[model samples]
Target: MHPSTPTITAQPSRPPPPPSPDKPPQTFLDLITSVLSLLLVSSLTVRSFIGRWQVIRTKLTSLQSSLSLLSDSPHWSQNPLLHTLLPSLLSTLQRLQSLSHQCTLSSFPGGKLLFQSDLDIASSSLSNHLHDLDLLLKSGVLHQSNAIVLSHPGPSSDKEELAFFVRDLFTRLQIGGVEFKKKALDSLIQILNDDEKSASLVAEEGSVGCLISLLDSHNERSIQEQAVLAVSILASGSDEARKTVFEEGGLGPLLRILDTGSMLLKEKAAIAIEVITAEPENGWAISAYGGVSLLIEACRSGSEATQTYAVGAIRNVAVVEDIKMALAEEGAVPVLVHLLVSGASAAQEKAAHCMAILASSGEYFRMLIIQEKGLQRLMDVIQSMPSSDTIEHVMRAISSLSVSDSTARILSSSTLFITRLSEFTKEGSLILQQISVSLLASLSISDGNKRAISGCVASLVKLMEVPKPAGIQEAATAALVSLLTVRSNRKELVRDEKSVMKLVQMLDPKRELVSKRFPVMVVVAVLTGGSGECRKRLLDAGAYQHLQRLEEMEVAGAKKAVQRLAGNKLKNIFSRTWRE
Candidate 1:
């Protein structure tokens, strides 16, 4: 209304007064409520932590009680149950302590996170300790005193009393005169070699350490020989006993005996080493300690029995590939071949087995054996009418050697080799027949071998037709398959209507075709691929329905074979000739 002068416009009512900042400090009741809630949360956390701690403590207490019980039992020293359970309990305690330490470390001021790797390392260490303890327990050293008494079993002999007697004998050996110690050792050896159970008891009695000590410290050949024989007997008793002998430093002294002792001593030591190496780990130990070289030397120069034992030891250790190669490097191949050629029948058998193991190492060793004329020697063994065991070894050796194509050709070229093998298939034992047929199968891979084995086809078919062992039948079937691969062999097989029927019968749908199916199908496919007359003969023998059935099966090769047979049949029908 007053435009000229600064008109006094009606102002809008002012906004309500801004709120004041004069609120009272938090009240005591509110403070108390907040404190109570915080305390409750803290108490819950503390209770949870206490519960966890109590659980861990209870576990620790229980473990401690178990340990105390074990230690307090009077039979703890001689009871086998305690001997086994104590080590396990101790290992558990160790593991628990380790875990507790980890927990403590995790709660430390600057501790890093406990990683999975830490737990794994702890577990691995526990496992290894337990394994070592188990070995120690199984060694029977803990209960030896009781075992000796129980094993001896005299009128006045309780296990405890027997243990006392053994303890007395050990004491005498340590403090008595030289003659007394020698006599004690002689008696101990005699008792140990009485039987396997006695030997096991003596070994469990912890005589391995004493025997090894005697072998090392005494120069008496009789005592040493007897000690070696006892050790050999003990080692042969059980795998645990063998491991005990090796673990107690017996292997080194035994190897030394083999290295430098008299012929009789070396012979006994070699046998003992053989038994000791029955545990594969002991073999590794012996090879590591240079026992393999000494063994090879003994095999080369020792007497027939010595050589037998030494070569046998070599065979045991040669299971390790590196040791096998080491043996070949140390000229074992030639020595074994020589042994096979001229040694005693036992030596020859062992040498043949050793040669087979060596050859199986790889193609290189196989070739080495062939070059050493090992194969020729095996052929000679067969020619000389070796024993059944020797024949088996020789045949297996030849089978291993024949893995190489070149070796197979060389074998096939040997005079009377194939003939002898065929004769074995016809007239030998089941094992001999099986091995001979298998070798023939391998040799039959070559065309020349197929031709050579053709004459034996009837024998092979007869083996199948009769209720022979499955191994012989399977091997003969495989040999027939190889031989049937040749067209001439197919014609020969077709001529024997019985053999052709046998081949067809093997393909029956209900029969387990695990090994026979493919081979039978192969023979059928080969026969069916021949002239129409061959196909007609097979059809007459009831092969068509089986071929049709197999064509529908899941086997791809078998299906393809059926398809080929069907196609050939169709082509023959379409290309028929009609005469006026």
Candidate 2:
């Protein structure tokens, strides 16, 4: 026995085989289920949770059942809401497990209140996760996740596949987290840009309602910008989409963006507004939403694109007869005039266009423009000879303002305006010629403007000779008739044989762009205002045939001018016979 006891081997106690490390979760469903299993184990075995084990067990069972459906989902791994909620869920479970283990001890390590506080935190975290999961289930986020596969948009996918996918995108938009919505919006925008027909698809899917809902995201500028821009694309995509946007109560949110969003956002919102209100039928809703004031304010600040689109929106709204007064009251006219003075050419052109629309409402807007120093701004822009497109719109604004004698007097008094306008009649596009001719005619209504306009007669005559649209020619004829009221202008016209010949050529019935009556009126005006040489000039230019045909065409003033010419022709024959 002593020999056997001589050498006793010391055996190291095998530490309880390193409590089998829980297997790692391989997928989203596996990870979620693993946590649910841990919580289930904790409820059953943790001594401190004895009283609440049934409650915790019931909660986890329901959680497990709800998530089992997620396991069956094809794209469950892509559920952003699940991903976002997972970390919180895991952290709370770990904390609860540790805390519950500690609670099993005889005394509270951190005292009773501290232990209770830890328990409250763990409990609240679990409850919050459950609540969020419930909302996710209700929101059909699982279904939405399936649509998120559209992020890549398989190049080979057919329209039907894409359509089914888009239907899911809109579902997410109807109810998804902020980041999820951003992803959905990004995917939808790309789809729209890639496929020309995608807009109508999304619109038919009620995308307008989803997008408009995001415009109220005052806390999220990026989301707001993306949403409003998406709205703009859909709105401009087709008239039907625009109607959908209007029907979806989108106007209010867009105007809200104009008030609170960034400059770029304001531009996008304005663009959306422009497209929505493009139909005059939508104007009242904008006015009802108090968008007019926001739009006017937008024209005052923000980027050039913002101002331009804002002005364009106002112009569209102004087309509604009922909203015009409300638009003016919002100070749209003054704001527009201010832009004309200081804004970029594109914005100035749009501002001018909007003001032109306001002016058409009647004397009130015209006076408003004049009171706002719009005439001064108009002259300023015209002096610069802005882009042809800009000039065309500016000319329209000036023409609108010139519709009123009061505004006309102010415009006419600016020598630079008349000089620049006269220059416009000679050069630039056909629209410029027509608008300038019309503007000059309007200005010439005041006798005092005629001398300032006499310088324009040569250009007006040149416009007639250029063979342009009938509208331009008619406007030039009217301008010439008005200008010839001044003796100096008649001299300016009759002294140039080419000018008289151009006017006579316009009398030809074959000239489609010309109104015979206008040319005849000018001839009559020349005959009434010019000397006998003018009458002989008419005869020499072969105006008699047209004059005789004028009465048949219901054109007045030609017969009198024809008689004057006939008398001259007969007198010349008699004199020739006597001499013989």
Candidate of highest TM-score: 2
lDDT of 1 by residue, 1-580 (tens): 7568765744323222322323111222233234323323332333223454444454444434433443344433553333333434344434434344444434422333343445445445444434443433333333344455223345555554544444434433443346656665666655555444555555555445766777863556666666677677767777777778888988888889888888888888888888877667767886678887798899889988899888888878888877887888889999999999888888888888888777767888888888888888888889999788888878877888787877778777764888788788878887788889888776735666567667777778777654455666667767777777777877887788777776677666666644446545555546555566677677677777776776677544556556655766787667784321
Candidate 2 wrong stretches, greater than 4 Å: 1-151, 154-156, 167-182, 193-196, 206-211, 218-237, 303-305, 403-406, 411-414, 428-431, 442-475, 483-516, 529-533, 545-555, 574-580
Candidate 1, superposed: residue stretches over 4 Å from native: 1-168, 217-219, 403-405, 424-439, 442-455, 458-478, 485-501, 515-541, 554-580
What TM-score quantifies how close candidate 2 is to the native fold?
A: 0.68
Alpha-carbon shift of residue 319 in model 2 (angstroms): 2.8
Instruction: Report clashes for each candidate as comma-separated counts.
Output: 0, 0
The numbered model that scores best in lDDT is 2
> What's the TM-score of every candidate structure?
0.63, 0.68
**Model 2: pairs clashing at backbone N, Cα or C within 3 Å:** none
Clashing residue pairs, backbone N/CA/C < 3 A, model 1: none
Which 10-residue window of candidate 1 scores lowest in summed lDDT? 20-29
lDDT of 2 by residue, 182-239 (tens): 8888887888777777778777754567678788865376777778778888888888
RMSD of each: 25.9, 9.6
